[model samples]
Target: MKKTTINYLHVGYWLLVLVQTLLVSLGTGVLGTTFDWRLFSQIVLPVKFLQVLSSAIFFYINYLFLIPVFLKKGNVIKYLPSLIATLLIFTPLYYFLEQRLYPMIGWKSYDADLNFWFAVMITLSSNFINIFLAILLSYLMDWRTMRIQKEIIEKEQFKTELAFLKSQVNPHYLFNTINDIYALTQQQSAEAPNALLKLSELLRYMLRESDDQFVPLSKEIIYLENVIELQKIGQKGLSFVNFEVVGEVNKLKIAPLILINFVENAFKHGTFNKKNNPINILIIIHEQLLHFQISNQINHVKKDKTGGIGLVNVKRRLSLIYPEKHELTIHQLENEFIVDLKIALYD
Candidate 1:
């Protein structure tokens, strides 16, 4: 995951390998009964040094060269033949060097009683196990790298999709609000100038602030208030909009433009020619929980496809950003449409 952590793991693994190698080499009576510093320095150390060097060479050949070139490419045909040829060439050369070097170090031959072919076979078998372990370790490292890469790609894709969803909200909302402003201008109402100012502020919020992954809850509330004001200007008669905030929204942050979708949907489908139809929106924060609810009397008979698309986009955004931390529920009663949403803000 982190470079320092990976370095530590590599250090630990090599230390373990070194300890195992030391135990294998020193466990035998090659150094004799008493521990002699001169004997260790002169003979035993040299023999062990040679052994480690040979093993390291073989190990790296498989780890660095063979595994990446052949095994990673899935070229079993070439991989097997290459391994066999390496063993064939290395076995005799290793045996010949050991034969010449052992006597000089006062090293007794364990394979002296055995035939040459048997000794060669034994060396080949041991070297094969070493190479196999090296290859296995290489595979494990490659797999870890691939898994980390996959997670990074998935996270980037999720952010891209969420941005796309957020972008959709701005254009759709601007279209509706512009229509409301146009209606007011046609009527030549005194509220048209105020509505245009509110529209500009709302546009500034959407264009500038909504680009962030999260925004202040207070700011979002102000945007909603502007939307409600714009909607009120276009409609006449008794006021049927009710918005209430029930907690101290000091440092709270939420996904930008998330709460506005439900309010827009309510206003689009809830209003009627009669003054009886009303839209109610409520927001409350208690501890780490943020709760939002919206309900409106449904006056329209047929459902618009655009509203459905907006809802789908919001749902997708919520799932991507909050996942298990948020719950959203929509209900349609006899004459009312309701949305209840709860979000865990701490995480």
Candidate 2:
């Protein structure tokens, strides 16, 4: 409980008990004296104060020690006995301090003589109320604590999944680059050194930024440029390329490796030039949106090399990360293929 709430509840409870005691005292006025402020301030105040203090102390001890011990031992039935013991321990301490000790200290007693049965009944009722409230409070505390634990576990699981996904991107990109290098080496061309250097630069990016989930848009563009340069080395004079970046390059950030796959797919499947259509790519940032377009010519009838799987993976990732925040389009017009993508940027 918040300290303020506990304090209010503590005071409110005792005030209720004091009012009950006053009513009882007033109801018995016919047998003795009537309700008087002088008597209350001098006698009733001292008794009420002692009763509240003793009750509070006993309640604290019972909840802090007795209840936990009972729960730990799985002794639900022992709660009644524990409550009885707590009352037995506190009642005398309060009665003795108010009636006996205060008398010695020159404080008048708000004393009443009743049949033993009535006192016993009052004590039993008080014990019942205490036990009921304590159980309810403890259950609320346990429930709130358990809810917080569940939230922590869910957050941790999400972090683990994100880390796994991030790790997967690095190796997947590296494997594709390695395959490119192998193809170039098999040809035994003069461009092999340049290809190796490009591979080294790509490896450097993977090592330095692999652990990062997000990178500057400019860094990704530079990496894509390196890949394109490396691909050009093997193409010799046979390949024609048209690359354009429109608009100013400002402080924009995006998920790493998101655009690379489209670039890679274009180069892998659309290299032939029968229709005079070479690889064309456009990447621009305008009004806080990343606009990308890539198209290449497909001359021969390839056997659905994509198999409708790789792009599916990208779509799944976009849904998981961006949901309704992105747009993508694909078209295959005779010998020409095209992909268009647009994503919002934060900066």
Candidate 3:
């Protein structure tokens, strides 16, 4: 609970205590009996206020100190005895104060009504109420605090796992890309520097940006574009990789690396040079929804795996991050494998 809310509860609780004290002191008999203004003002009202104040003291002492310091550690030895001692000490303090305050404040004291043992029993019972309330509210607060902490820890652990899943990659992609870069350098190809730059940006994003829970949708699209560009570079620019985007991708954020694994799989195991069955990648955004679809013709022989994510892990990530806000479907035919993913984006 919030601090302000807790403070409000405390205020309301003390107000009820005040009301309870009034009800207990000035009972229905006060309405029935002859009005004794002196008794109500001097004897009953002042002593009742003192009783309420003492109850407040006992509540705070137990709630803030005794419960946390001793009972929280299950130290009954210190906790129980300390509680009894506190009760004994404060139970009679009221009568003692009353005796003194009556004389000093020049308030009329009804000596017969102020019996010592009677006052102690009353104080003891009220103190027990404080004890019960203190123990109950203290533990209730502790439970709420622990639940909040557990949720925070779980969210952090979830992010750590998601980032680990995103970072997993097959080494062959780097090897092939590096080889492509070397070949380009040897042949004096113009795309070599841009390919290297794209590789640098991809790595930078994978290492740094992907660690964030969400990245700009625009940045993710650029990352996807870079991946396609670099993969084409490795195939000597002859790979028929068709990429398209539609609608607004700006002012929106998505979970990082969410779409990359499927695209990489399409490039890894799909036909590259066939014009009739080329790889198809599309991204569409409308009204805070993103639609990502990718499909490719089976090459008969599986190509090298690139960036890594099994379907199981990707599904788990989507469930963890987006849950009911996302939908995913996969389709496999004799010659083609297709993946369709849609997500509710955040702006």
Candidate 4:
């Protein structure tokens, strides 16, 4: 049985016992002429005891027989009928013990109506009331419990997804930067030292801020600049990339790595072409609304499809972190792919 149902049944047990005690006392007063308060107390006490015993026995019968059949094979027909049958079975047994069995054990009987009619009336009334109450309470408790469990599950899933996003951002960045460094190592470039320095700064940022849900917008801008510098070391010429930031950052915190994947995607795909191809990034913050726009000039003649994993990861991260709080638009033209994102910042 559901928790609320059991609770209601428990409350009903107490109410029933109190009512029976009151009725038995009144009946004792009417049936006898002496009207001794002690006699009334004695009559009420055994009724209370018998009520408690009957409640315990009824609980056992419901637990052992009624619940299994009701839960598994029950329809509307079986539900009410089986409960009524169980009540009928137990009531006669109880009346027998109350009238004959207790009297044999030197316990005086209270009222001597241990017949079929009274047993049937009590059984039908009590079980009918219990059935109605139990079903309603059980349904409500089940609904409440289900809602609470679903909310807990969703929170846990969101946390797990956030952790996964952070992991994706850090490793994806490291792998790309390391690949660029490997190329510099092979070609013996003059900007290799600057690349290593920027790499170290990027690693520091990751270690410090990746574990947090939000980081200062200024910190994120610095980290983006570091990544851009590292990417520039591997570029063949300055014309390959262009980045600009126009924003006042005093007290704003945003989800980190929100803009890096676009830049990374741009460089990974746009760098191989030595033509006038360019990757443009512009970020502006105004009144707690940050607008980020990135456009990468793609060479459709020689476009590479191998650089989309980081972009996809970042998209997933943005969705998880900013459900209804951010807007992302992506457009793929013949020669360029553009991404525009507007995010709300919080302190």
Scored by TM-score, the top model is 3
Of the two candidates 1 and 2, the one with more favorable TM-score, higher being better, is 1
TM-score of each: 0.80, 0.64, 0.82, 0.63
Q: Highest lDDT among the candidates is held by which one?
A: 3
- Per-residue lDDT of candidate 1, residues 132-169 (tens digit): 78888898888998999999999899888987888777
Ranking 2 against 3 by TM-score, winner:
3
In order, candidate lDDTs are 0.79, 0.69, 0.81, 0.73
State residue 283's C-alpha deviation in candidate 1, in Å. Answer: 1.2
What TM-score should be assigned to candidate 4? 0.63
Per-residue CA lDDT of candidate 3, range 13-66, in tens?
A: 888877876676567564246767786777667766776787899889888998
Q: Select the stronger candidate by lDDT from 1 and 3.
A: 3
Query: On residues 225-290, what C-alpha lDDT tens digit does candidate 4 reach at each position?
Result: 888777666554454556777778869999887888887777655543454566778989888999
Q: lDDT of model 2 at residue 188?
A: 76
RMSD of 3: 4.0
